[model samples]
Target chain A: MPYVNVKITNEGATPTQKAEVIAGITELLQRVLGKNPATTVVVIEEVDTDNWGIGGEPVTLRRRRGL
Target chain B: MPYVNVKITNEGATPTQKAEVIAGITELLQRVLGKNPATTVVVIEEVDTDNWGIGGEPVTLRRRRGL
Candidate 1:
């Protein structure tokens, strides 16, 4: 079983968008890796900007500084 | 950098619990794989029962059928 995790900043992604992402990733793995969609687990995580970091700083501060 | 994603059913896990999970995973990676905690990313995704699937059925249906 292939477990895929997609992490994205919490920017109000709609349910439809989340569904599409799950389907797309499942289909991609099936097409490219011959993986079974039924056994493949795709998890989507929407992280708060304050908890997401880059370049040793949180995304909130990065966005605040317009970086 | 090692990225770890923990997926669990939406069961009222508190922020403190989530933080502990992150910290625990980070420390585990550091001890086992020599990964840097600063660069290690741990994401926790609490999925709805309706969305989580097992054995060709959603968890919601499985729970309803008492499987």
Candidate 2:
């Protein structure tokens, strides 16, 4: 059961962009990993600006604390 | 942007087993997808016996309905 869930947190991507991203990733997984596309469920979670991280640190916290 | 969220729902896995599964998948991604392991955020959410599906049907619902 190889269900790939994709979570994206960025301010510049719209719903269409999110859909396209998931579709592209799904295709990649199918082609590269030989995973069945039918069973692979790609979930795209669009996190707001308050819940994101980069470089082992939360983006919001880093911005708020100036770290 | 390439955060992989793995959600497993079954009655046959412990936390350490789940972690190993994630680690194995991460290695596969790094080797096959050419993704950087350092930046790859792999989240494993273990679900109880309620929220699982198979063959275009919910497992719990199917069990309850005897379908």
Candidate 3:
């Protein structure tokens, strides 16, 4: 079984967009690894800007600083 | 910075339970790997039984057959 997890910044992704992401990831895995779609699990998690950071600064703060 | 993704079978996990999972994972990473909690991200995703399978049979079907 292939379990794919995707993390997208909380930029207000709609339901349709999320569905497409799941479908696309599943298709990619199937085409590349010949994995069965039935056994493939694709999960998308939208994280808060404050909880996600890079370069020792939260995304929220980084955005405020124009970085 | 560490990003942790947790996938759990959708057996009606409550918000409290999910929180615990997130917290526990963050703590484990901090204790073992010395990851900073502020930059650590933990996301939990629940998968449907019908979409999750093992041995070429969906989990839902396996449950029905008591397998």
Candidate 4:
């Protein structure tokens, strides 16, 4: 089984966007890796800005600093 | 950087439990794979029962059937 986990910032993505992402990843894996969509698991996670870090600082701080 | 994604059924896991999971996975990767915890990313995604599937059936249906 092919498992794909996508992590994105929690910036108000809708359910339709999430569903599209799941379908796209599944299709990509099926076309390239020959994985079965039935067994392929795609999970989308939206991380809060404070929890996601970049360059030794949280995304929230980075955004505040205009980075 | 080692990125670890954990998927679990949405069964009311508390924030403390989630924190523990992140720490545990980071430590495990550091000990076993010599990965840097500073650069390691651990994300936890909890899937709803209706969205999660097993044996070609949704988890909600399976749970109802006592499977």
Task: For candidate 1, list the clashing residue pairs, or say none.
Answer: none
lDDT of 1 by residue, A1-67 (tens): 7887678899787656666676777778888998888887766667899999999999999999888
Chain A only TM-scores, each candidate in turn: 0.89, 0.63, 0.90, 0.90
Docking class of 4: incorrect
Judging by DockQ against the true structure, name the best candidate: 2
Q: DockQ, per-model, please?
A: 0.14, 0.23, 0.08, 0.09
Each prediction's RMSD over C-alphas, in Å, is: 7.0, 6.6, 8.8, 7.4
Model 1 lDDT at residue B25: 93
DockQ of 1: 0.14
lDDT of 3 by residue, B1-67 (tens): 7876666678887655555566677777789988887778765557799999899988999989987
Which lDDT tens digits does candidate 4 get at residues A1-67?
Answer: 8988788989899999999999999999999989999999998878866555433334566578887
The order of the candidates by lDDT, greatest first, is 1, 4, 3, 2
Per-residue error for B23 in candidate 2, Å, reads 14
Interface Cα RMSD, each model:
3.9, 6.8, 6.2, 4.7
Best by lDDT: 1
- Candidate 2's C-alpha runs over 4 A off are A53-57, A61-67, B6-38, B42-53, B56-67
* lDDT-better candidate, 1 vs 3: 1
Over B1-67, each residue of candidate 2 has an lDDT whose tens digit, in order, gives 3478765555466666656655665665555445557776778676664667676767677667874
| Model 3: docking quality category | incorrect
